[model samples]
Target: MPEAGIEPDVVTYNTLIDGCVLTDDSAGAVALFNEMRGRGIAPSAVSYTTLMKAFASSGQPKLAHKVFDEMEKDPRVAVDRAAWNMLVEAYCRLGLLEAAKKVVDEGEGRAAGRGDGKYKRMYVELHSRMFTSRHASQARQDRRRERKRAAEAFKFWLGLPNSYYATDWRLQHDGNLT
Candidate 1:
């Protein structure tokens, strides 16, 4: 594009970063991000959110957190509900429930003043995930208890006197031996 005298803008760079992230090339995305900044192109919320999502999908939630932190510190970037949602999702994907809950709480607090609905949705989703996890754990415990009960019943049947092994069935059927 540069060779054709077409200058890359923020949107162009963001698109390229999105492609890189989709291809699992976080390094490429970061390089493109830095290049955009070097070229005096300010990153938008979409840029940071894309980067955070890439890092999260790559199993690097800490890097995602760094991206979120950078977004927060940048005055030009508006950390919207979408950005917060990405950060919370990253934390949740890593099974950092406490961290995700913190994000949800912060989002709710901000939403209360701004009247935004996205933050409320984030809170609901996080709570749902927590509930699902707890329910799965309870199901596993119930299965274990069921297996224990079955084992105990089998043991009791084996210990019953005069049930099968304690009586000689052949002798009882025929009084005289052949």
Candidate 2:
């Protein structure tokens, strides 16, 4: 299209990216997204959603999360329910049910205030799929194990002798262990 003297706008780039995503060409979609940014075309919510979907479909939920984080940090980009839906889907696909549930809960709260039925409906669908998934059990087990490890580590740290803390404080503050 550029060769045809038809300058690609944000919509054109989004369409190309969507095509790349649909064809399972996530790398190509990313390249086009970068090219779009390089050309000073600001990506809309749809652009980010498309890229997130591509990353999700490619089994790179972490990448999708990174894209979602970027969208959240960019004030120029308006994050709508569609972006949230994609993120929830990505987390669900990665077996991160807790993370997906967190997103769904947050989306539900936001939707409640906006009176948007679409957001609520999407949240319900994703929540049901997440809980019913086989990965849900694994996710729960992993979270429990993580919490147990964290508590044990914390207890060990807290159980250290007061003398050790005093020595460390003396070394830093007085330049000598008392």
What TM-score does each of the candidates earn? 0.62, 0.60
For candidate 2, give the lDDT of residue 49.
Answer: 94
Could you give candidate 2's per-residue lDDT for residues 14-122 as a string of tens digits?
9999999999999999999999999999999999999999999998988998999999888998888789879988988878877887877777677677887664474
lDDT of each: 0.76, 0.78
**What TM-score quantifies how close candidate 2 is to the native fold?**
0.60
Highest-scoring model, lDDT: 2
**What's the CA RMSD of model 2 in angstroms?**
17.0
Candidate 1 accuracy as lDDT: 0.76
State in Å the error of residue 24, model 1: 0.8
Clashes of each: 0, 0
Q: What is the C-alpha RMSD of each candidate to the true structure, in Å?
A: 19.3, 17.0
Candidate 2 residue-wise lDDT at 159 = 43
Residue 11 shift from truth in candidate 2, angstroms: 0.8
lDDT (Cα, 0-100) at 42 in candidate 2 = 94
Which 10 consecutive positions of candidate 1 have the poorest summed lDDT?
154-163
